[model samples]
Target chain A: MTGPVLTVRDRGGQRVATLSLGGLARRAGIVGAALVVDLAVLSSAPGTPWWPGIVVLTLALVAAEVPDSQAPLLTLAVAAGWWLAAVPWPAPSPGRVLLVALALLVLHATTAVAAIGPPGRVAEARVVRAAAGRAALVGTGTTGIGALALAADGRVVVPGAVGVALLAVAGLAWAATRPTRQ
Target chain B: MSGWHPTHAHLRAVVAGFGLLVAGLVLGRVDAIVLATPLLLVALAGAQSRPSVVPVLEGPQGALAVHEGEDVVWSATISGLPAGGSVAALHPGQRWLEVEPETGQVVAADDGLATTSIGLRPTRWGWRTLGAPAVTGYDAWAAWRWVADRPQPLRLTVLPSTEQPDTTAPAPHPYGLVGQERAVRLGEGTELAKVRPFEPGDRLRRIHWPTSARTGTLHVTATHADEDAHVVLLLDAVNDVGSSGGLVGERSSMDLAVRAAAVLAEHFLRRGDRVGLRVFGDWRVSFLPSSSGRHQLRRLLNVLSVVEPGTARGEDALAARQGLGAGTLAILLSPLVEPASTQQVAMLTSAGIEVIVVDTLPAELVTGDRGRSPEEQLAWRLRMLQRRLERDRMASLGIPVVTWTGPHSIDKVLRDLARRSATPRLVRR
Candidate 1:
């Protein structure tokens, strides 16, 4: 009656900056695995022994360091830039790997949080389900293209051609069918 | 309102997305563009999403106003929508004019839900103010946190049954308002309308004998005028109904006070008298100077419904509680639990407002566990105490106290108060 009752307001989630060290290690491992059967580059340049592995390792670490959403874009730019700028050497095969998968993954990830309902609450199951569904369908299409290119070239293409195809497909699809309803 | 809780779908999505991000870097997943694009897009979109809330008001019963004792069909409506949203009206008081959830159309019946558009039914003859409609929208389907709403404060006054009209009380001061009006105007009445029925006491000179005899019945055509008996009904919401409260709704003392106010207001209105109300609790009682007919009844009932109780000191209430115009009778209803309130009533009567206190107290409650041994003694002592206090208080003021003790007691109390009113003024003090 005398003064207004003071009730404390609730603060939501806490913000965390950047990636943790564990995340970096995980990225490094993924990149190393991708290079396991990839002997095309190594086979062409006989003199370069551990250098190719080292480069892949470095790329993987850097890519992992990039946040999930930005990771794909940055990886595309960095990987393409690195391969183009590098000194010319006889390479066994182009790296068509990881491109389509990465592109689809980015597309899928964006749709994950793109919801149309009330604000502040967590993303709804329907949105998540739709996003996940789309991601699966997209991931299959994108990665399948790269795999096809890989088989055809007998080596993973550098600056992944599969990624280019996936990007074109996703972009076309997105532009063609922008949802009319919110 | 209905809301969703965090489910496995959410966790799974997070897992798959994060797994790819980590896998992309470690395995150098598809070209860098493939994995990185989706992650970045998702993150950006998620970040861009804003959270908001919609407010809604719901009520019991259909959108139309309802009276007490009637069946209630309550419903709720939501407002302040979130995107791609869904709402479920929960609880028994959910009355929707229509129920079409797929199209996102759910109407609620109630009032005061500010965030939501209000839908209500006047369930009783008092103001029906509803709490905010329960509505919580989420950014996505996930109901991360629910926001409790402040009531969309609404007021729907339910006027009591036809007001009886308080034509009985005489209004001397506050010029324009005097006594209850009739068709044939009286020299002492307020307004002059018409003359129809003739009584035995008709002045011989004033009679229209030819018209009366021709009509076969002794008749005097009367006129209609604006007149009223100014009576103030003071409500005491701080009452106790009984151990279990009252009627299935657990109405409590406050309910009695409200109903009493409604009935009294109706009575005063019907008699074509000016009536006002004075509520005691959370909000100050209302005052409408004496007026006549059905309109005044509507106004009084409306005020009764919205009259909130306040914490004004007993004495402060005492001053404003009785809106008197010299001869206005103050019909007060209180439980008289506290001495402060009773003292104030005594003071009002002393100041000349004809005070009549209706003790709307709760019935005494004691289960089998409560010993019956001292019942007689306790009753005797309580009665003695009440009498002593009441007698002492009335001795100094021209007022009477009526106790609504049990079933079938209202009529008796009304008669008692009426008789007391007829007593000589000096003798009353």
Candidate 2:
């Protein structure tokens, strides 16, 4: 559904602008930005099955083009990525790992957006954002720890670790402020 | 009670985010994938959410009487809660509405329960019904999502605008039986009669004491003849306010006519006069005519309240009034908006009934907006002239037209009516 909103009109012919497409685009962008941060953390972590987690993250980020339920799908993808990273795989280049992280943010945003129709549930955005924000916090923490380990080994993968934490925190904040379903 | 609201845009956002997450996962961006993944899921849940709304309505006989400019309160009791959340009811109308979240009258039960009382004032009159209502809420903790369908609706009947009465004057002559009109001989009234003078057993009051004393004979005075009057109300619907082409509200000449008719009917009934009504407008739109009793008044008011935009269709013509024979004082309530309506009233006057025309039309059908060009001003003046001519024509036909140009109390018509009514005396020649 486009999400539902009540509208009122008067004799003067004034109409209220309820759920508009512009809001949808913004939500998608928010989820997209958050996914980008999350992917960075997963990339820098060591001893993680890089491919599967990278693959899921790629899906989430790319799907964020729509930015609706992509957060949930993105979360699943991130979980899968983590599981895959736990398995053994060929050593990947830093640049390639970064690309996978960015992909996750894109996928989540785009895929979730595909589900929206009309009646514009502008209120739901907040709830979804809040929930996504909490999950983002956890993901960011894991990214930070991974970055610290790399730093101790003189690897110093600050870019990936910091990006994940910041994006997660941002997503959480956006979600918390939005008016979503109770 | 409980519901979720998932916007399509939110879902679209999820889909977009999901696509981005997928790409990030394929690219080996673990942190980005994890962050984007949660957002995708959240968007999905929100997308799936449905927002539901319910509204409670109550009043005497299930109908509420809301005065003009007075707020009519609509109370909605909400239940079914999500964690860490509150409910909000929003109506996007210009009518300023006051919403009270918690009040003494509101009772709450369960995890989340709140009542929203909204107040609205009607600036004008007529019928109005509430559209679909929307209710939305979120978790207190700001997690998960919920939405429900809300179709709460209420119908409102806003009564017309009216002003309170100022210093009042008693009616000159009471028209009804209770007021003054009493009855007499061989007939249909309520007054008592008397016994005449007697040769032997006559009472003192009946003896005509002065006449007996002077003439050595007794003669008694007898009483007869005083009763209620019957009135027939005739409405000229041929010329309407809309046809006049003035300011939308002022142009509603028909509204004025109908309102006048209603007042007349009410006043006559109160005074115990038998009142019958006839409409010259398109009665097919829903017309009930010529009846008596309390029920008839209700039917008349119902017709008056139910007004729709219409034209002076040829359905009710002046010639059709030929059936009104005589003695029935025909009161024609009209705006004289059109020349045709004027001609109709003239014909009525020529026919025999003492016809009174309550002309409610303002000569200026339109006064153009400010800063108009000379050409525009000329056009407005021409329209005004046309209306003036129509009024003059009707007056020239010997019809007593009471031109009601206001800022005047609409009650003037009712007051004048009660005064003019007198007992009808039939003389057999």
Candidate 3:
């Protein structure tokens, strides 16, 4: 009478997440391709360091190869690597920063798709496609905003009032995005 | 059912975005803020899109009854799932219950409803509990998951496949009102019994004009009455030898006995015979009096489905023998594991019950015992030898012991029993 409920626990101790050699290779290829793009864009910036790019690449690869449970940590590491790469006094160009952000998004999306289910199970094509499509939409919007910021003639003044306003907006965004528990 | 919880994917994005934003503001880095802005936007969008209503799962329900190897679709419908997409994963509780394409993805329609199905095939016969498969619903972004709470475990009753028996058994004794069997006492039937002088109560329709004219007297045709027979199936559940691998694996002695009993019961019941059952094992002896009809067959099979091998008790065997009715054809289906069952058969034959011993022991047991030590093997061989001697004793006493071989397994034995039933035999007072 009752409908089937999805449980997190694996019955019969069955391994739900499995990584096949071919599946691993396919995931590795996606991570490798993303890394190449990230490195290429970061190197275009005049003062970008090589170590940060290498660190991001390593984290991205690990995220793609590990299980879903551990992939989030690696994803966080990749973000931290990006932050390290942007630490120089004279920041990278807005265009290059935008490109690096897009690359990181692609890596995160791909890793999420590859690692979500029972072990060794190949994710459905539709799921991967949806994730990619969403990432692309968000990336396009970010690119447009970055281009506009670069076009502005003078530095925007951060008055205390404006700073307070921006902080409030960020706070609102955080509150709106917080996950709700049943 | 567990409540909604944030997935690691969502948590990672939120933590990384906030960490970068705080670090950028503290360190006076404009590029870092720009970099963190996109991730924060994504996290915000995912969080705001989370629907207030959780999906109400409707089923994994389909056929609760099926034959071995038959496939049944287990499906669940979610009515309140937000329009976008979700993933549903089904995990079967038992190995014998196999699910095809274990997991499924569903996209909700404009009405916010999605239905998903998985094919399940049960590989064995019995009343088996199809463990409650946990169905977890994941959001499109794989950010949030909710587990539905199901109240009861799903149950599947797998019936054994009925093997079509190619041979028929002649009724040893028929005593019912109407049936297919030819009765000894003449009354009214299709088969002619004899022609005799017409009696006062004889109907005019039964008169034979030619016989009346030749004999110079009124003569009427007499025929035999058709009566149904009572068949008693005695199943030995004292012990199960060898390993049972469901439908695909090697059948244990208990499996053989149950399947064979089902086949015989179906055959006789379809022929208008009243069939009964008696099972003796560790538990008390269970008995069902002879009855005829399709419902009776169901009752017989239901009883068989719950049968399990138990410790042998000599008194249970004797108690099972007491349930046998006079003039019934009692078919003893057993592996002959215990000497008490052998004695039970000897008693049934001596009581003029007309018994047939169907040897339900798997042939693999003789060679399969190789896994044991040499001394244990010797003991098994000696026990088998004694079993062989018991069978020989039954054969000498005019009881036919047949080994089940599917289709025509009992044809020869039944044919011989038919021949023996025609001759006069002494009846115990």
Error of 1 at B170 (Å): 13
In terms of TM-score, which candidate is strongest? 3
Which should have the higher lDDT, number 2 or number 3?
3
Ten contiguous residues minimizing lDDT sum, candidate 3 chain B: B101-110
Chain A TM-score for each candidate, in the given order?
A: 0.36, 0.30, 0.60
Instruction: Estimate how well candidate 3 is docked, as a DockQ score.
Output: 0.27
Residue runs of model 1 more than 4 Å from their true location after superposition: A1-182, B1-227, B236-255, B278-310, B314-327, B340-356, B364-429
Please give, for residues A33-144, the per-residue lDDT of candidate 3 as tens digits. Answer: 4565456545655465567666656666666666366554565555555545544544445566666566656665555555455434434555556767887787787677
Clashes of each: 119, 204, 12
Candidate 3, residue B253: lDDT: 86
What interface RMSD does candidate 2 have?
11.8
**What's model 2's lDDT at B137?**
43
Off by over 4 Å in 3: A1-70, A78-100, A114-128, A145-182, B1-3, B24-38, B60-63, B103-110, B194-197, B208-220, B282-285, B311-314, B427-429
lDDT of 2 by residue, B342-382 (tens): 66666665655556677766444444321259886676567
Worst 10 residues of 1 chain A by lDDT: A1-10
* Best model number under lDDT: 3
Listed models, DockQ each = 0.06, 0.07, 0.27
Model 1 DockQ, alpha carbons vs. true complex? 0.06
TM-score of each: 0.43, 0.52, 0.83
